[model samples]
Target: MIGMGNPRGIAGRPLRVLFLVENAPVPGDRRVWNEALTLAQVGFQVSIVCPKWGYPGFYEERQGIRIYRVPLPSLGGIAGHLVEYLIATPVLFLYTALIFLRDGFDVIHAANPPDFLFTIGRVFKWLGKKFVFDQHDVVPEACASRWSGIRMRLTYAIASWTEHASYRTADIVIVPNESVRRLAVERGGIDPARAFVVRNAIGLAHFRDAQPRAELRRGRRHLVFYAGVIGPDDGLDQLMLAARHIVAKRGRQDIHFAVLGDGDCAPQVKQMSQRLGLGDVVEFTGWVKDDRLIADYLATADVCVVPDPKTPVNDLCSMNKMVEYMAMGKPVVAFDLKEAQETGGGAALYVTADGHAGPEAFGDGILELLSSPGMRESMGRIGRQRFNEFLAWEHQQASLLRAYQTLLGYPSVLVA
Candidate 1:
């Protein structure tokens, strides 16, 4: 079967899930929305609580799931982030209190980048609610990647302590990759059996019957596509530098770069591109939310690039972009990191991870793949096959179901 919907019933009654996320809005956050749908399909009365990242409304219902949104504060430096989380905590707690007062949840599924939510889980756990810590990012490493010196050390400690608390509070730890699962067990001292690896995968249905938009190529010999947050760890600087190397240094005026998505570094990246004299050679479409635009970008590009320079957080973390690229039957050029290599397989052209050399190699890789349409097509075919076989969200959902089954202690007869 290409896909599996969550079964209609569990042990006796419909399972109730309270999903919580600190970052990103519902529906916009594809992973959370997909998980909510998967759980809802299985007869779980799903309710999501998330920060409204400038989205209108404090509450709404979409596709049979109840979504509650809270105000998201403007992002700033380290202190600003702290203020944001501190502010969000009370709002979430108040919202959660209301939910429990009206209709309590059976399972509290909390996704983390900010890991202190375990305290709320612990509080709910006292009232017999099961806590599931969905480890989205290793906060310690994420902090380390974002900063350095004493500030880095302090952030690492805070992240480490909170992550440990989260793990200790969790009845089951849901991780996106084996590396993360291993981290939970080894570093967080979580029980190995209690940790589950639910990979980040594309919802295959979204790409079904999707057609190429040749117009997105924009009169260029080759279109290089990149989409996602342009943070420090994201290596947008490296990407811009590589584009400069290709266009200005190597004199490849025929190729055009379409850098989609945005983050804190977006303005700087745009400025850098201009300073590099990549005039008219690069396009920065900041934070594209339009599905058709994103689809067109993915469709028309000859190759997609995963420009995350190798870091502790990035190395272990599986990229949504790489998987999305493959799902779209597009080949990739990425830094050779463990999980990235594991995720893309033969679908990506990897550059050795040696800082400056990596971007140079990445540029070369784009050129190399662009030169051969047959190779690009072949790699895309390989990627799409691999995605269908093992990497699609449909396949990944089985593990999610099984994880819930285990956490709920449902009998074999209750397994979907």
Candidate 2:
């Protein structure tokens, strides 16, 4: 695969950047939206290519940025992802190729793995476009989550290989956290200078920093909140078990647990919550819009939770909800993953990582935090401070800009 090593004549041209995304729409994705808006604000001509969703037909140019959407086969299950990739990849390449043919782009910023867009990036590279690989998910871990058989095993092997190739091809590789940054250097054989860590952070300015809604917290005895995707990797069952433990062992009926956001395991998680006799206290909100998230849930919560299963992949990757929770200045309780501890620091009450820690320890941790408002407030303070210092989007924006500045100065471009 041909990759962009360094860009020539990329500086001072209002970088004609093409951002390629997998499933989500342009404006809807928080990270991608953040990047697009930031780049546009900084005088770059940004165009996002993604799958068509509920938004208007095909092309749109809103807020001095162009967004191009192509029809993908499906957005549902594994079958849908496969179908979407099968059709979407070709259409994506052709659409991008047309754009390249018409107006040569300065940079091709591709986000992924599923890693489908590497082929497109390779095609563009042959035509002299600079390639930037934004690593989102660890493909091998995702593969391990879904598959157990030989077929999936082979697919996993191929995806892993492709991931490495993406790193080798990229002029600059960006990962969300330092752990993945190390992987890009060690596994991908990329230079340390070429790898960047652009973390997932809350746009602190955008999130409504209102007083925690006492009204929402009033009717409930205690409010326990969990947000983000309910995927297999996210260990929702453990959270349910903790809910059950809270009710059965501790007789803690005063606390109500709200699970927000939907994923593959949503239905089963709901069933498990119900079966655990948390019929009243345990609830699911299922993919609330961002505005609703701020207004209805996060603004009112007493405590936030992120219960990703402790896996090799999770330990290395950072969870954005934890950062979001910190952005809102809410105390958090999560399973003890190394990165969580690093990001959360003393801000979160970490439950043990033992398989059993899912429910019982979660119950204990939440109860401990709930019992001490002073401690919760302190944790929240430290968390918000940490957000400002390290994890906010404004900070990441600098790194993103720097990476581009470096690439844009390739080959005889003065380093002024």
Candidate 3:
């Protein structure tokens, strides 16, 4: 075991950390941003190297953390993804080297989707730097969910290989949920003692001060909110179908559906909504960055929906939106996914099935929630309580810090 005999680092200097993220940008990627802030609060020098998607500039310092952004092309499809990864890996490596030469980092904390960050981590490990592999998603499963035929098989094989490579290269592994932790141990063959579960939870201060904007309902009697990425695998198309069923079939004109956030499938989703005659009842507010606005939408929401259909990836991965809805004291309607059930507990109503039947069932679940004010209130209370007790970022911080303490060779210190 690597031992420093001190919490900071060898000789009592503050331990420096460099976060390598290829999927998303800093601050925008709430999970990484939350982790960064938590480590910074404990006196660790933190820096992030990520893609410049929504955020501009090459570099910036925010709240004592340094962020280095690389401009990357927004691409799609199997071939595009291959080209994108090939381009991203080397550019990100260059930034990592630059950060090491200038500021220096004791640990290379790499979050994965492409799972290729381990290649860079392996090089740094040779130079005596620690690697913490933060598995954000099951890449192989995600590839399967997004593609089919030869492309799916090829991508899955490559993803599986890279994922295992990442697990083997890491000094410590951090997962978002127990399902992922189990995968890391059993499938990736990592030691159980070295893997940690640090959920993608919201901070306590999140939405603490924002008031509900009733006006956001937009003259409707009830508001149903859905937030996060609108990818094809995310089941947004199913959600639009649900909206059509509610409005056209059930004749429930009293309810309005608000979708916040954008993704690769945003245009397709919008087109479906229009084609289904849901333009009036459904509002697509693409990517609301303002915290207060998001808080307002959630606070005013009668019910929040997680339309992620049952798939290998969706079943195993935790959804951040579900927890966020719970944090706002809003009951959720989600598919009966394993991690979703674990995360939601009694806070959500799970709809079973997939395809056309799934959306119909999902619509029925929404209607059931809308029909009973008392049930919604009770479920909301339960969700909020659960969030406060076990699912908040405050609770997850201890595990994250413990993982770092173990990796850096310091005795575990209580976080808060």
Best by lDDT: 3
lDDT of 1 by residue, 27-81 (tens): 8878888889988876689999998886789889999999998886756568987
The alpha-carbon root-mean-square deviation between model 3 and the true structure, to one decimal in Å, is 2.2
Clashing pairs in 1: none
Q: Top model by TM-score, which number?
A: 3
How high is the CA lDDT of each candidate model? 0.85, 0.79, 0.90
Q: Sorted on lDDT, highest at the top, how do the candidates line up?
A: 3, 1, 2
Candidate 3 lDDT, tens digit per residue, 62-134? 9999999999766778888889999999998999998899989899999987798899999999999999999
Provide the clashing-pair count of each candidate structure: 0, 1, 0
CA RMSD (A), model 2: 4.2
lDDT winner between candidates 1 and 3: 3
Candidate 2 residue-wise lDDT, 218-304, digit = tens: 467678777788877887888888878888999876787787787767888888877878777777877776664554577678789
* The 10-residue segment with the lowest total lDDT in model 2: 1-10
- Which residue runs of candidate 3 sit more than 4 Å off their true CA positions? 1-6, 414-416
